[model samples]
Target: MFEKIEMMRMARALGHHASQRQIAVARNIANADTPGFKAEDVASFTDSYRAASEPLRTTDPRHLAAPDWSPADRRTLAETGVSPNGNSVSLEEEMLKGAEVKRSHDLSLGIYSSALDLMRTSIGRRA
Candidate 1:
C-alpha cells in the first residue's frame, strides 16, 4: 500500500531502525551490573540511504545511474572505557541513547505523516 511511495517506505524503514536501537539500549542498561558485559550499539541512520543502494540500471535518457555499495546493521561493541569489574555498559550513555531513539522515532513518524498528507492533498482532501 503506502510502501509504493518512496518517502513513506523510507520512513517505515527508519521507524524499524529506531526500534532496533531502542532494544540495543535496553540490553545495555539491563547488563549494566553484569561482569564483562560490553556495551552494544546499532549503526546510525544518517549514513546516506543510497550508501548501500544498488547502482541504478538505465537504458534510456530518462534514467539516471548511481554506484554499488552495501551497508550492514552491525552490532559493534561500544568503547566507553571499561570499569573496574570489566563491565562496559554505562547507564548514562544508555539514557542518552534512549533519548536519541525517541527523536529518531519521532522523525520517522513525522516523515510518514507528511507523506500521507501529500497523498491526501493530491487526492483532493484536507490534511
Candidate 2:
C-alpha cells in the first residue's frame, strides 16, 4: 500500500513539473513579438531527474537544488532577423518547442494516469 502511494506521488510530481515546462514554452511563444523579449525555458528534465533520484548531502545551504528554472543558465538562441525593427524570435523554432512541450505534458499525464489505474487494479474493487 505504501509503495503504491509513493509511486503515485512520484508520478504526480513529474506531471506537475512537465505541466510547468509546457506553460513556460507557451509563454515564450506568446511573447515572441514584443521588443527586448527573450525566449525562456524551464530547467532541463535531466536536472530535475538528478535532483529527484540523488540523495542530498550538502554541507552548505546554498548548494541545495533549485525547484525551478535558473535565469543565469537561460540562453537566447533565436536567430537574428529584422522585422522592420530588429527582433530575434524565430516563429518556426517557437512553434517546434511548443509542440515538443505539449507532447511531453501529454506523456507525463499518461504515465500518471496509467500508474494510478494499475494501483487501483492491484487493490481490487470491493464487491
lDDT values for all models: 0.80, 0.62
Candidate 2 RMSD to the real structure: 4.8
Off by over 4 Å in 1: 55-73
Deviation from native of the Cα of residue 12 in model 1, angstroms: 0.6
Query: Residue by residue across 14-45, what tens digits does model 2's lDDT show?
Result: 66666766666677668777876665666666
lDDT per residue (tens digit) for residues 38-97 in model 1: 999887675635544445667898765543222245567897989999999889989999
Residue 20 miss distance in model 1 (angstroms): 0.1
Off by over 4 Å in 2: 1-6, 58-86
Q: Could you estimate the TM-score for every candidate?
A: 0.81, 0.63
Candidate 1 residue pairs in clash (backbone atoms < 3 Å): none
